[model samples]
Target: MHRTWAIIGGGNGGQAMAGHLALLGERVRLFDVFSDTVNAISRQGGIKVTGAVNGFGPLEFATTDMGQAMEGADVVMIVLPSIYHEEMGRNCIEHLRDGQIVFLHPEASCGALAFKKLLVEAGNTADVTIGAANTLLYSTRIITPGTVDIFGVKHSLYMAALPASRGTRLEEAIGSVFPNFTLCPNVLYTSISNNNAMMHPAPTLLNVARIEAGQDYFYYTEGITPSIGAFVEQMDDERIALGEAYGFIMKTLRKSYFDMYNSGDMSESDSLSALCKKVVAYREIKAQKTLRTRYVLEDVPYSLVALQSLAKIAGVSTPCIDAVVQLAHGMLHGELDEGRTCEALGIAGMTKADLLRYVS
Candidate 1:
């Protein structure tokens, strides 16, 4: 029954979500740490969402003020990349209230645990329930300063809360806003389900030459050749192995790619190169202009590193994951280690059984 929403991020997903929520007749406040985006949206008279979801929804409160953004809000949404999750939690922890619900749009690897760590470190004992979506509700891009192009909206998504006991309550509250959400067993269920980590890093990393050359080509179609697909398959094996260790099975990389752009039925080409030819949304998504993009910078650290570290807890070997990290370290000259770690996430020294009990 709570309708007041505070969306934290000015990225495409955040703007699109604000519009969709407003279309549902809910009151929304949007917060971005970036002042320029806040000022731009404010000066433009609100956000304009186009493509998949279209509308102009005025953010009731838009500011850099964490206090102003979070005050009186029923749900505070994290809509940015996982790289910002820790900082966001740290920034907003002081103002988080007892009944507030903080939702991570797409739970990247161990995101719920990392954000919750920030809260606990800040001494927050508020009855705040932390939850995360398995995948972003929308495939979107900010077309302009205050305009966003939404390509797709996920029909159904899984979400879960830490401490599992709060899952049903959070589910019912969010179900009012997005009726298709299904409550998952725990945060790792959603974290392991992240498709972006499986999809982004390899293709982008393998195509560094094209990206650095500022080449404009369809990333999936041209970049992820059958050869590169082999690397992705190897990486996926490492990821799936860790998940299997915990009695969890994640979608195969091929199935995930098909689900995003084609009929999700397992009838398509299993070859990643052949499968990329089927993606429609990625037709114009050119390679990054530099090796510094999140495909390498963020995912290698936050996504792959978190997974590999957790794999250690389960006594799982992630040689493929380590290979990518080693290669990225060579390319980036060592900013790679700064991403999320189970230790930094406060899950260090935990065994597989210990982690299950802790996250659950």
Candidate 2:
């Protein structure tokens, strides 16, 4: 059966997903806020992605009109900035119909819950299943207006659904698009497993002098030296502790790093030289910089902020994460505390007893 998939945010990730879904013969619709990008996709039919899979075909539709793109979509994949999820959710509440499934690719916090709040505020009670993840499935980018490059597609993409009652149906819906949907126990574990939240802000804040110093930086592996990696690992340890306190066995950031850059363990390559060799191989295979670059700017606010909330709930000290949060605030010239904190997201104010029942 030919299914319909709408990819929100017509940037690199959206385009890459649209390309793969189209390749699977799904009716793909791509949308973005930028009119020029929409026009470019419309004119060129679709983006041309290189590596792993290569093909070009006319997108079923390309538009800046959210209603038009979502009116009949069976599955809607959102890849926008985390800050924008509320606005997008509001829009979706106004337009989403019954039986449609909305997927937040790498939901930072409880995006499904936030989105559900929007739906309730809109007085909509439609049975629209919402699913979210801790991280995206691929590292990809658009080199130009209509060209996308996928560096790597993850082996497993973890996800959880709102209400916890809709997880099975949500999994089945997304599995239609990508067969690698691994059902997480819930959103908390998925959120904790996100490595970017811990790694991104620390390095970006630490390397601000360099990033602002006008030197061209490479991938994250470039900035993550021994000492920096240790700092990042410390933050990751705090996150793991928070997860354990909350009763979720979250994966360690070091293990996730090994999966991404090495062989999933330092013991596999005990020396810095061996790790460097693995990093070189990672760079040589593919070099798309959208998600890799946004990890700091984007993940810090959403993911790190959530980590801080979890840490507070668990009574775990997160000095490193706190420092990075402050540093990110200075770098962005805005207080992330306003929108990135638990209280800001309408969750921190809840007591532990309340949170357990809520997320549960």
Candidate 3:
């Protein structure tokens, strides 16, 4: 089955996905708001991918025009940060056609719901199915303009669609592009299963001084010390508890790491810190140089705050999660309150059962 892809965003993940698909002999078009990024790839005529998946993936074109990018795409892959989900949704509403599938590479939390809400609010009745993966398929970073380095590819990850009923349809449509995606119960499970919400913010917040001082270090190996990892474990527990409250049991951070990486040397008894240190993919990743990086700004607001909102609706307490949110808010000068919440996601007044039924 051949498919044409429209890849939105020109970041590391976007370039990697577009390049990988193009390398697989699929027709791919890359879209980015930044003209510089588009022109860079346009000049190169393709993305050069090295490391795990190495090849020069020639693109049909790279453009800033949304309509042109999506003109004939079967699958629209949004590979931006979660903060831009709403903005992208707005940009896509006027252009989306019936039967088009809009998938968020990593939705962070409630991304599909938020996107669907935007579409309904705009009164655009396109029969588009929104889906989300719990995380990106590749652990990759950009080496230069029009070039990316893939550190590792996840063995598997959970993916699901909004309205729950479209799960199978989404799988059938997206299977060729992401064969490793395992369909879960619904968007709630996929959102709740977001491991970044548990792993990123805690260690980043705990190591604020180093980041503020502009020191360099390995983010996972050195930043996540034993004490910091213990704090992250508490946050992960709250995430799992929130899932349980919503009738979904998610894997712990440690278990998720093992599942995604499939590292043979990982043990069931390894602590979170030990497990993180063992992951080869994370070894070369460096810590953020400043506090404004996505580790704190993006993850804190989009991921942690969203989780806190879900916990509120499910009547689940998340003290550890709350602590991080508060610390981030204070440190970042209260810039994170407008993140994805029940009201923002259009489920402000719904009960847990109502919310579950809505997705189901």
TM-score of each: 0.93, 0.88, 0.95
lDDT of 2 by residue, 1-360 (tens): 677888898877788888878877889999888999999889988778777668885688899999899988998889877878887777767778898888898687666656766776789988888888777777897888778888778887688876567788776777656777788766667777776676566766676666666665553546666777777777878888878877877767555546656654455434332353356444443222332255555677677877777677667788888888777777666534344566555565676656666665
Clashing residue pairs in candidate 2, if any? none
- lDDT by residue (tens digit), candidate 1, 1-360: 537889988788898888778767788888887898889888866788888778887768678887898899989898988888877878888889998889988767888888888887888899999988877898788888788888888887889988777897676778767877878788877777766777777778788888778787777778888888888888888888888888887778777667756755335666877877766666677766778888888888888888877888899998878888877888889566577777788888888899889877
Instruction: List pairs with backbone clashes in candidate 3.
Output: none
Could you give the candidate ranking by lDDT, starting with the highest? 3, 1, 2
Model 2 off-target regions past 4 Å?
260-277, 281-296, 330-337
What would you estimate as the lDDT of candidate 1?
0.81
RMSD of each: 2.1, 3.3, 1.8
Error of 1 at 19 (Å): 1.8
Candidate 1 wrongly placed segments (more than 4 Å): 43-45, 213-215, 263-269
Q: Cα deviation of 149 in candidate 2 (Å)? A: 1.8
Order by TM-score, highest first: 3, 1, 2
Question: Could you tell me how far off, in angstroms, the CA of residue 249 lies in candidate 1 after the best superposition?
Answer: 2.6
How does residue 73 of candidate 1 score in lDDT?
90
